[model samples]
Target: MKIFGYQLGGEKRSGSIENPTVPVSAENFMQFFGVQSGNLPSVTIDSALRVPAIAAAVSFLSGSLANLPLHAFKPKGDGSERIKGGIQKLLNEAPNPEWTSFGWRKYFWQQVFTGGRGVSWIERNGATTAAIWPMDPSTTVVKRVNGRRIYVFDGKSEYPASDVIDVPFLLKKDQISVYSPIMLGSKAISLALAMGDYAGGFFAGGGVPPLALSGPLPAGADAIKRAQSDIRRSIDSAKSNDEAIFPIPPGYKLEAVGFDPQKGQMTEARRFQIEEAGRIYSLPPVFLQDYTHGVKANVEQQDLHLVKHVISQWAKALEEELNLKVFGPRSNGRYAEHNLDALMRGDFKTRMDALSRAVNSALRTPNEARNLENLPAMPNGDTLYIQGATVPLGSQPLLQAPPTGKENDKGNENGDGNDSEA
Candidate 1:
């Protein structure tokens, strides 16, 4: 029999069409329960430890048991001794003693795949205590003094002491949502962004929802109008130029050109040209506002891929710009593999500092060196704005300058008195 896609060896499946029920016999019950009725239930499991078959049977008998007289049944001889033995067996099966003493290892850990006290943190006076993961050595869980459901984790070590870090959100319900960059106070939202669930992430990250165009007026109506106007102007210009060069060939009516009224104003000339062009000749209509909007929407929807590509490009540019050797697990389309093995085996603190330095080096700002004195300056009176000396149009400025008496003497000394070459 298949239960939740698992086959049970040698079990008969007999049940109703609407609500299927598994058949159970005294022998099958004993085998399934791991106890014998002959010993009067000597070794029953703990009340906290519930099995499917036992739970279902108890549920089925609850209503029926109420109808039967409670005082009608009598306890068998030494029944109290059997009960004591069962209780002892249950106490023996209660989880490891260290789990109870250390508080981090919770009882319901098997129900979840990710976290427990390993997932806990500490807070003080309604504030997060410190960063409490692999890096942190002393973070603990904080519980409200009198409340049953309130808890807080203070992340002072991971962040500045001033910020209040919300910890309940740090642990995500889904594994895919866990790798995102953590926000200063909003770890949940950051994780959502890293997982590429932008809309969900935005909501989780305390971002406002996008307004839909449900009524006659859209939220970005003004921007859309401006964009559409710009698009129309370009198309109109193209149409006018095309019309001037090639006026509609004689006797061809506009209706015969297959224009749709619902699609708004479109130039017949542009449509004809587009139709004439085959698939390969067709372009992306870069100037069209509607096309641009569609492209932007698609890119925004798949922004993670774009971000990854941009990061890769930046990393490559950084490698070329800075003469530093870089190392990454997934750089240059090759896996780091054992390249990081030594770092993993060595002091993690030193490795972390090295990684930070390398990343910062790659992102260093370019220097702007200049000779300030060589730059042009404004006139003394008009010191507010820098002005370049104006050169007169008619002649070279140096030649046009009013001549001093010394200049004429210098010219005469250079044989400025003209004489034709003999």
Candidate 2:
């Protein structure tokens, strides 16, 4: 046998190769396997957005980080001086001409989830950062030359490592960029989405019937053919409305052919898909709307977990990138940080309890606690008030015995003479 000009199970014929080309690309690999090219997985960012699980994960992460306060601070003594004015406006109000801080953060976070890299251009003024603009990940590429990494934007412009703030997710060794979740779990995501589409179509088409007609046909061949055509027409027409009856001729009976949705495990399959997607994003199943195992008590813990594990990582990445590109190395002790208290804020009771403890323990002043709640400060709120009974261990008592009035009276009576006692 001869296969692609090569002998198989036959005497080999030696000949000098006329032409040869290295198969390095995906297309070439597929061609070698006799599979048609250009059939790449259809799991792009836009397509994945159609999945609820992907949408929820992206939203939860981006929204949580973006909505939280991001502040720049300069270390001074025991506290820090918040960098205000233009810098603060750029962070809290607008990061660029087109997008606000929230929008910018959300866009970059989405990029991280979809493409594994979030890149932005740092626009500067004199010695301070003016604005930060996001670059589309699809058009942005990272290249290394002469032991220095360079960022190429849209294949037209090149930016130095210092000018671009790059946050890569799931970074690997000896690699310039990060690994995308969608790319790594494309097969699973695609399968889940495909199943969802199928289920939607199934329900939309009035679902599968309980049973299908089978057995022998009645009378002549023409009658049998007519009966089959009528049955198909009836089935197709009845799909529009489940209440529509499916009529069958005599001598024909319905027989179970397919498993019901419950027995087929459709719901379980969807639940599994949700869990899989959550795992890919490092999110809890509850965040993806899978509340099967969720409880009210654990929900708060889950949120905390989300902050500690998922949101904190992204926040730290953004903070470091901002500190480096926005503030630069010469900034000294200046750095950016996200206030996670916003995410940790629970109900009224929780907030009040935390504030009470903070104030009573002298960790924060009453004015500081009120400021966090956006309330006005009181006259003496600046004073740090702790529990009157709370005292340092191994320290003298703050209270001392009262001065004796008789001692003072004796000093007055005797003048320069010795003191007298009762």
Candidate achieving the largest lDDT: 2
Candidate 1: regions farther than 4 A off? 1-113, 116-141, 145-166, 169-419
Q: What is the C-alpha local distance difference test score of candidate 1?
A: 0.29
TM-score of candidate 1 against the unseen true structure: 0.15
TM-score of each: 0.15, 0.78
lDDT digits (tens) for residues 328-369 of candidate 2:
878788888888888746578888998999999999999999
lDDT of 2: 0.79
Show where candidate 2 strays beyond 4 Å.
Answer: 1-41, 209-225, 236-245, 250-258, 393-422
- What clash pairs does model 2 have? none
Which one wins on TM-score? Answer: 2
